[model samples]
Target: MSREKLLEVKNLKQYFKSGRHSVVKAVDGLTFDIYKGETFGLVGESGCGKSTTGRTIIRLYDATDGEVWFNGENVHAKKSRKELKKFNRKMQMIFQDPYASLNPRMTVKDIIAEGIDIHGLAKNDKERTERVHELLETVGLNKEHANRYPHEFSGGQRQRIGIARALAVEPEFIIADEPISALDVSIQAQVVNLLKKLQNDRGLTYLFIAHDLSMVKYISDRIGVMYFGKMVELADSDELYKNPIHPYTKSLLSAIPLPDPDYERNRKRVPYDPSMHDTSEEPEFREIKSGHWVLCTTKEFEQYKAEMENK
Candidate 1:
């Protein structure tokens, strides 16, 4: 079944001018749509702007150019504080660092009530406290922990608190910027499972950003691979794992560890050299197959199509 697009990002560009007069093109000319009730994973290296893209979509960082339309409404354009407040309640973010994201001085109950207070969802102090307890329970935490601070919990528990905070607003769309990266390896799956359960129950739409390609594939229905500042490939999770066309995509796939010890030792890592591709002409994202998008120049796009056909 086809899903409806809840959010659309068109030609989004984020660039920062450095001291030397050179610009750091954090996210350049990227365009993609996230469907409602589905997880769209954005993966790449640390400096590839995966986080920047997520930040820009949520209006944490203003875009240098382009448009982000949520439910056909332009989010980047200026709006009254009241209008922006409504948007904020609908779209929430789960930051990457559990330790840094939460306020140490604030109790969990007060932290969760931040959104409820902003939107005036609760009528009184009693209702707000009840809402906070409900959110803690929803994220798999006990109600007794509500009085505790961020310093009392482990990394995994801290992330769960972050999740609870994002859910406090009862958002329709969530931008999870590596929510599980800061947690322990054993606890990573727990958080992922919680996110999946929340999606099933709440029908939440997500733009999940991560540098860990394997984790992204497991949670995301569709995945987009970004390079230094541009999207290089996008396709269904299974299709991308089986057939990665771009040099950067292939390199990323090759780096994932194999289960078999023998195979892992012998696996050849592909090095991505952007200079190999002809870039005199500006590259554009083209559909190389049904729902499979790739960034390439005119000649390279044709070559990619032919290569897929031969296979």
Candidate 2:
């Protein structure tokens, strides 16, 4: 991966008033950087705020606290319409649910061309039509499929259209929020391979958010483990899988089933007990190894250091 940081999120937080008496902290104090031309996977269980983090960074929802810096400019800061439009073109998002994200009323051509229209990437109807057709072909769909509405396409096809729409603006960074979770098992790999091919061709940067650790390991250069809206661990994808430090991360990794019958039979699910943490002091994110970070208290940090040394 490149050393240059394309996107930096520092202490980002998103909170919502659940009701008159309760507040839900969807994302709290998340800090990470995505390098140019690299995939940074954000993995966690549902309701851990991985989706909220993506939305907040893309400015779909205003952040309750902290800052998101994209290519050196603050994302949460207010900008003029012209500046905002430019920023929007630089960053785009692919939603989780293919059926819900696309417009049932609009044709595939119109849907893909929405970004082109808003950004004025094309000059006229002819150019727009050509661009849409090009994008459709780029995402594995043909020019003939352009006239059909989203409802006519299958789940995987709809997602390809969604990807085409995001790519229409030629964005430098894309937040793929659980893009494959809603697809069938067989179709998931196809979508992932397409995303990989697209990234290779376009030199794109991605924040691939998902709950599937196995898939995340396959696609991401680096991974961050989130629990209860806080980032508990961050490391190289292979490193994290080889040596998961946090209790929650270990618990998560243990849950992935192997294809082998023998391995599946022997696998023991590691139950995460949050109460095991040292509560005398609040846990802080600290670098235990060169590039690995984990949230832990002072005592736990020492123990983790010893654990690594012994490993």
Lowest-lDDT window of 10 residues in candidate 2?
Answer: 75-84
Q: Relative to the true structure, how large is the alpha-carbon lDDT of every model?
A: 0.93, 0.95
RMSD (Cα, Å) of model 1: 1.0
**What's the lDDT for residue 27 in model 1?**
95
Write the residue-wise lDDT of candidate 2 on 94-118 in tens digits.
9999999998989999999999999
lDDT of 1 by residue, 130-149 (tens): 99999999999999999999
Candidate 1, after superposition: displacement of residue 68 in Å?
A: 0.2
Per-prediction count of colliding residue pairs?
0, 0
| Candidate 1, superposed: residue stretches over 4 Å from native | none
Off by over 4 Å in 2: none
Give the Å error, residue 140, model 2.
0.5
Pairs in steric clash, model 2: none
Clashes of 1: 0
Best by TM-score: 2
RMSD of each: 1.0, 0.7
